[model samples]
Target: MSAAFDYHLVLQSASKLDHALELVWSDGKTSTFHYLWLRDNCPTTLHPDTKERTFDLLSVSADIEPLSFSVDNDRLMIEWSEGDHHSQFSGEWLREHAYAGDLRPANKPRARSWDAQFLKDMGSASFNDLTTDDAALYSWMKQLDQDGIILVKDMPATEQALDDVAHRIDYQRQTNFGVTFEVRSEPNPINLAYTALALPLHTDLPNQETPPGYQFLHCLANDTQGGESVFADGLRVLEDMREQAPEHFELLATVAIPFRFHDETHDIQHHHPMINLDHQGNIVELKYNAHIASVFDLPEAVMHDYYLAYRDLMGRMRQAKYRMQYRLKAGEMVVFDNRRVLHGRTEFEPTGHRHLRGCYVDRTEFQSRLRVLARQHD
Candidate 1:
């Protein structure tokens, strides 16, 4: 049967439910209303409120019956009782409120994968061959998008090179912790030390209201024995969580855990979910930092469950299946999207000197450059 003839609706003229009344709309185009849905969502008594007071439709009597309805121009005038109490609704409004089309499921957008074409498009130029032009930088960024990390080999090992690389993108994010540091004196405790230490896999600046959009680190000197930076695509970790521990994934998605970073110089904290998702529940970002996570404030029962789930998720994150490990050599700079990728380092002995200068740039500017380059190529 055709959809138009599949459903039927009845409307009565009288307010009393017991009254025998004529049906106004025999054509199946009009929507059928459940008595309870109309009564609770009715326009007049339970009308959409301004900020005056909150209303709970769930607490109202579900048994309360809807008496009748009439057509007044484009509106459906509803009468709930023999008394003159009435509610008016536009047909367009009713259609919007009542219709649930198809109810069939669809697949989410698949994450982009890396391939040879992506690598070639990134421009296979050695660091000596790199230039400060739109085409070269765009190719480099496309490479980063494909591989989650890219190395610009043999860049001039100078502070000016760091500035040049950062400025290649149109927009730069000037953090209080702007690049180029040496192991001279005590910087902020939160500032990443140049000394050799195995930093945990994490997305940076979780304490900020909106963390730095992107990060660029230039390898000034990597003569130290072993200080390899490791990168893991946060999106991959989320996909694994979705498959192996759906409940834990759901818990992380729904709950907001707190993060804090404090020292003599700075104190900041905020609550954000680990797996950030879009309104449609597609995973968009990951915010994971073990050292900065504050003690969660929840009920004892919920807290216990949360700890177990958080631990399991972290264990999965640390696995080799999701990681891409590489070391930055001198004159090579790596730029990555802070919101989508987590980065860390393997410790090297502090006996030898190792130094890297870094800075931040807004992601919108980076994407804008990419589009401009793509247009030029087009």
Candidate 2:
């Protein structure tokens, strides 16, 4: 049923002004709906099956006004002066979409930043629970959204085990590296992740137009001497930068820098700001990889300042207070938002065995699954 028939909102009174409808709702909330807006949004304007708007603005007069309107059966009914058309909108729908005042939040959980201590207190879900229980899966995903990372333990010691968890959320993101990538020390590797050298704290694939979002690294084996995984919350680091060095934050968020990756077959390059902010000025993503960062081709006037800002952020991200280090054991998997979490690994003996199977799932898929889970549970 439409809100027009099922909703319980009661319109206290409705009056016709020169060009708008002034409505006083039962809860003492007042709203003004313009004449053109009301005519354009008539219930008859929408197709019954698709619910898509079929009304054309050109069909109505530019100075169109309602000849008369009334409140009946908890609905605001209006008769248009032009074409003798009529419209009836539910009080519930109008109040839900009111634009006269501050709107309610979307009800999504806000991200929480963490430090080194988070490793000890962080939550984890067993692979069995995640696969078997819908509530368990939803809770794990909720925590992932909150902290941008989580550890999944007690997984089966098999290659396909990682795929099972990834598919539960959505499809894996394919890149030049293929559907999934293997992390190990390989000879003449095209990426530094294939080497035993110490990898710096960085987000993966800043060079791509649309970089991968969440990353899942399943530790199939880890018997190396010293290959402790390191992670730093990029959101935490930048949040501090915004407060302590506002100038640096401004430059990094405004300037676009080049990132490039080249191999025998593929050469991917893109330019993006180091820090991306939403319209509300909240940090949404971070793209910082020193290895893949191309030469600074900025104007000389801003180039020196940009480097100073870059170094400041780099230094802050490397600080011990912001980073958490942990060595993964067999049958353990770590999933993190690649766009918000900076990850690295320490140097280890190449002779020893240390292998991890990994894959990527974009942010959109992760959020979509979460919303669906929420709907199911609700």
Clash counts for all predictions: 0, 0
- Give TM-scores for every candidate, taking all chains together and pairing residue i with residue i: 0.63, 0.87
TM-score: model 2 vs. ground truth: 0.87
| Native RMSD of candidate 1 (Å) | 10.5
The most accurate candidate by TM-score is 2
Candidate 2 segments exceeding 4 Å error: 1-23, 31-54, 61-64, 72-74, 81-83, 102-109, 186-194
Report the C-alpha lDDT of model 2 over 1-378, residue by residue, as the tens digit.
233322544677888776788888666657788888888877788899999998898998889987788897668988878998888898777776665422222433379999888998777999999988999999999999999999999999988899999998999999999888998764344654556688899999999988899999999888878899999999999999999999999999999999999999999999989999887678889999999999879988999999999999989998999989999998999999999999999988665678899999999999999999998874
Global CA lDDT computed for model 2: 0.87
**Each model's lDDT:** 0.65, 0.87
How well is each residue in 201-287 modelled by candidate 1, as lDDT tens digits?
998877776677668777777766667888777777777778888988888887888899887877888888787788777776778
Candidate 1 displacement at residue 295 in angstroms:
1.9
